[model samples]
Target: MLKRLLLLLCLTGHVFAKEPPDVECLVVHLKYVHCSWNKQGTPEVNYTFYGWFVIIRDSADVSECPSYLSENNINTGCNQPCGSRFNSFYTRLVHENQSSKEKEHELKTKVKLNPPTNLTVHYGSDSNLWLSWTQISSNCVESEVRYRINNRNWAVVSIGKQNYCLNLPSHSSLYELQVRSRIGYACGLSEFWSDWTEPVVWGSNNSTDPNKMNSSMSVWTPVLSVVGAFILIVLVMMLLHNERWVICDSQTSHTCCSFLKDWFKFPEGLKEGLNYNERPCPVREYCHVRQSDSESSDCSTCSVTTDQTDCSVFIPVNESDLPTPCSSSISQF
Candidate 1:
């Protein structure tokens, strides 16, 4: 009678639960069951939560779901035992706000998470076989593996944990295997299983490849070598360019760097014209002919060969033959 009254109180309090908790429940890839709830608009000082999960299987109240809790006894989620063969689950979230009665909300639909990936069946040894997979999240704790012999109905394989190997197959045979994992939340265990990983077939003769370890290294070796060679070439070119910038471009007239600076210098033709001719000019111009200091306006010309670049030229002139001073004019052609 007390149990019946408690059940009635629990149900009657659902409307007063005040903003029913958003609830969700799912079976993950036939691995495990998960459920969670959120109490909306409830204050912490007034917030005390109580949750009850009714795990329904095959139209029967099979068991109560396990509550996942936090370090502070706060509700995280819930997990329920489920194996390869699974169908559905129902979840109810409860809240208490200063009252003996509780607020409850039940999810109308089932929720599921993504399954494990890269299911591979490898030959562990002549006598054993290995099954491997990747977890979807760190919350994932373990996998529920289901397998079959030939065309037989599936049965759960007992492996201790999901992330690591537990036990090898008792003996090698033609087998089909599939696996799925469940999450362990900071608050509690996930009450749902992710979808199953893709099935893998382990042939009796299949063996783990000995050279698989070397494959990754072999691929990286050539790539690294090429990258190293490219870097070396770039460094050499950079050094050469820096040397060009310092040597010819330096303002200091250091003798040591002069030859190299000029050798590496860009051709003068790139900026301005260059005169390569070394031959002397065939003509000359002379002006202001005068004899001695006493003869103020006398001059005579003498024929002489001189270097074309010469700045000063000397000529011997007779005083009497010199020409009288006159207004200036350009030298005659």
Candidate 2:
């Protein structure tokens, strides 16, 4: 019986010797979010419960002691309670990593402004343009908004908050505007950039017509003036002729009789009652008169009362006479 007991004790020792050492913590997977670790030990073993493990080395002088090897060590969990706090804790880690890598990274991130909504462009005075947008999200800690001209180098316009009023150099050039979310890394490696907006082309207030500056003042102005003057003359003459005559004497005076008698009467030496000499009047060469009543003689003057009246006389004048009419008239009874 004593031999069997000794053998049982030896077997127990062998089993314990084969058992693997318990790890205080283990690093499993890594991502932007939570990292996992396992604490392995017997339940009775004393455990400080360090949260995570990171590979670290000591750099102290140790000539008197054996050279210490660099080893993975477990770090204490964040002072705060666990839970969603892991997100905040992870973020802090990321920030630290970024600060360290900054020496090697070429690009830097700056949050000029938060994400803007309802972005719009407007033309300002002095032929300059302005861009305005609304702020919606402010997820970034330090943020900046960048602008590019024709998709060249990105130029940072403003930082923190959404409203940016950029004074464009010229209203004639086109522009492309976009927004991005900058985390604690290089600019290019940050979260995906927002989709590019439609191009906004600038416009000019100047007239589009090329001839507007070089057009002659007299060409159109004088033509319009002559047309207006002719209209006025015709209107005034019609108004005057429309006046009714009060005939108190032996002869009733018509509209044409007064105009003709005052201007074109024969000289006093002519016989009082002889038939008028019907010479080919020189005025006839230039002016042709048509009487309203077809039976009336073409030489007799006809009266027109309404503004709509057709002229009874047509004159063939040279282009030089366009500004004036009736430079000459023949005397007649």
| lDDT per residue (tens digit) for residues 1-333 in model 2 | 999999999988856643222321111111112222123422222113222211233222211111111114433222222222112122112121222111111112211223435667676775455665544334342244556653357777545554455665554334555544333332222432343334443444233334653475547898998888667656644554586342222233344345534443423432232223233333322333333433454432432222211234465656654422223444332
At residue 312, give the lDDT of candidate 2: 49
Alpha-carbon local distance difference test for all models: 0.51, 0.37
Tens-digit lDDT track of model 1 for 1-333: 999999999999967755544554555443565555533422233223333333453344434445463334555556666533223334444444333433333322233557777677766555456677776554435568887755468888644355333245544344778887665443235566667777887655222343643686789999999888667656654786676544432234344344444554434542131122233334343444544553553333333344443334445566666634333222221
lDDT of model 1, residue 151: 44
lDDT of 1: 0.51
Root-mean-square deviation (CA) per prediction: 21.4, 22.3
Clashing pairs in 2: 111-143, 111-144, 112-143, 112-144, 112-145, 112-159, 112-160, 113-144
* Error in Å for residue 40 of model 1: 24
**Candidate 2 ranges with C-alpha deviation above 4 Å:** 1-116, 125-128, 137-142, 150-152, 183-333
TM-score for each model: 0.28, 0.24
Angstrom error at residue 174, model 1: 1.9
Best model number under TM-score:
1
Q: Where does the lowest 10-residue lDDT sum fall in candidate 1?
A: 270-279
